[model samples]
Target: MNDISMRVRPGTATALIGRNGSGKSTLLSILAGLVRLSSGVLTTGRPGLTTGYAPEAFPALKLTAEDYLRGMGRIAGLCEAAGRSRVSELLATFGLDSFRSRKLAGFSKGMLQKVNLIQSLLIRPQLLLLDEPMSGLDLPAQHTLLDLLQELKREGTALVFSVHEPQIIEAMADDLYVLQEGQMLRTIHGAENLRSAPAVYIVYTELHPVAQQAVKAVPGVRTMQPAPDLSGISCTGLTVDQKMSDTCLQQILAAGGSIVSVKPLGGLGDLTEWMDPKDQIGSGRG
Candidate 1:
């Protein structure tokens, strides 16, 4: 049930995207040499050709984030003097200076994400492969990472990474590969689909058990779901006949429940349909 073949040329930014368990991470690991390919050849230009890799799994043992990055720098073959300077510079750039001495065990998910990114960027490599590098970052942090990628691209570093968010793909990726069932289904020629808003929204609220009850009273709620971890609840397959989301938002706020986030159900336009849509024309989806 798995198959993929890609020619990753130098100086190109490629994105790998797919639903959960579709093998994005597995493909990345294969490329990183952390895992051996089952039946294919992966050849690189040189034995010493630098390649920076950041995988999701981290060491469980006690160690500061700084310690890990410093070690990576040394292992990548930078001399002691350069490794020391590079590690310090990367830690500060990724906003982990305050946590320099803090053990990785206590780092928040977001902090761990920053450290993951920092390690990959600490020393300039000929190729950079990131696996969901922006998973836990705030908006500002995401922007910072995008800027860093742009810098790398300008310097002729070939970059490939995986991301689920359309916004991330729209803003950062130069090309996209959509994968499913471990097979490469499509290589999108343009990035237009990423900029369009989802045709439908599923709103979730904070009141939980009560919120579920009230939403049922609302005529537009077509489906109800218990939130992950039972944090609250959500509604989906909204009744199309009414203006439900705005009304639902008001009702939830009045009931002392806050809107957690809106979920996008795809009706976003096709990536090929728009040579240019006015609303998305200048925002730079491509």
Candidate 2:
């Protein structure tokens, strides 16, 4: 990492990518002011600048989420009323309101990670540093983090996060620093390599076993899920490629499918899976 030079401006996101033990975490800690730099000039945000950090591991805690968040809010210099309001909004945003009274001891790893992230954003600092924040998350949780990060980016919050998932880096980063052997090997600008976002469309239609199977023949269909009540299934899971959408619609109509509705699919991979009984069949569920 000798003689490494870098710059991250506001209204942008910078991603640090590296293999494990490549000192990505160490560099991130340095950026957060937790690691002392050995030498060389290292410039960062202004003095007295507020920073939000979400570490890889949620620290072992005995407090309930409510108490922990409130305490952190206070630590962030948030007044009681502001802290309470922010906490309530975040709990609902992450679908954790019902578990507000529960202790960290009772939380799943994903829930704990969400709490960690919520606390990080509680202050709305000038800089946000996250280390492997998506490591333990399921697909849905990963999508949640993605959405939140996008929101932060849009708000012009400078982000410097380390992640192994190229998809996330591609999606959120304005600049990427590829590191190896504690050295910056290469730098890639996100806009240069960025591709068009997936043109996902939510296609709701009447259910017919034959039509359902027929629509599966569509070239760009990602998932064909049966709707509840057995009335109609949704093509909501598919990533609608705009170029192929017209062809897909024609194929669906040919398959005797009647459109109930059509809309764009947004955040999360497929949250409908939560309603699936299979979700509770995992090790913890059993």
Candidate 3:
């Protein structure tokens, strides 16, 4: 990374956007203190500021999920009892309580990702850095994690994450940073400017099978899919026309469906096109 300067304030979310090998992950690592900066100065709001980092690829270990979390808590300076309690709480919150005793080596990609997040959250750090926090999660899991992060933001924790998902940037980002070849290409302060056109809105909902059919019958719902267990519908990419979005949402709510998130279709498009000179809106120095 070079000539990159940014600030993360309490209770705000910062998003890093870039193509592969553009140094997004490297920037996050530098913020997490995992990588040393060869030049430039780094400062924080307070000295010894606590920070947490969740990586994209989680390791598959022989240890059980519970053991792994507890070990992480201990490493974060929690006492034995506190570590055990925190482990149990996080496992239950992530709906992995039953799988606590299961070996991490046997866990699926989604499950391991949950463990990865749980470990980083062990200390309740003041600053959190996530390298693709939603990498391997399903819609429901992603919703749960988003809700948790929203709550953390409300509680005054600073969040900085690198992501390619437009939905995530729409839902969580307060500031957007576009990087190119280890340089700070542009910075957009508010995420609202990310939307190019309001043509389609992607709606996420959890509903019973009967409600699922009702939603499918909605006039403008273009696509949908069912949840893994068939307990509810998990729309892979439920694209609804902009004009019908409000009415469609109302009908889903009327049918007792829980709306997780509704985001515009093409808010952030292909990363390469972000450098277009004509697309400048909220671009500025950090």
TM-score of 3: 0.70
* Model 2: colliding residue pairs: 1-182
**What ranking emerges by TM-score with the best candidate at the front?**
3, 2, 1
- What number of clashing residue pairs does each candidate have, in the order they appear? 0, 1, 0
For this target, which candidate reaches the highest lDDT against the unseen true structure? Answer: 3
How would you encode candidate 1's per-residue C-alpha lDDT over 122-220 as one tens digit per residue?
A: 778788999887778888888888888888888888888887665667776667776665678767544454443443344544465675477667765
State each model's CA lDDT, in order.
0.68, 0.72, 0.80
The weakest ten consecutive residues by lDDT in model 2 span 277-286
Where does model 3 exceed 4 Å of error?
Answer: 195-286
RMSD of every prediction: 15.0, 14.3, 15.1
Assess every candidate by TM-score: 0.66, 0.66, 0.70
Ranking by lDDT: 3, 2, 1
**Residue 39 Cα positional deviation in candidate 3, in Å, after optimal superposition:** 0.5
The C-alpha stretches of model 1 lying farther than 4 A from their native spots are: 190-286
Predicted structure 2, TM vs. truth: 0.66
Total backbone collisions, model 2: 1
* Candidate 2 lDDT by residue in tens digits, 1-286: 4657788777688887655555577777888888777887777657777889998878748898989999999999999999999999999888889999889988888899989989999987778999888877789878888898888888878899887666776678788776655778766675544334445564556546776666667776766665443343443334565556677677767766665555544332222232122322212210
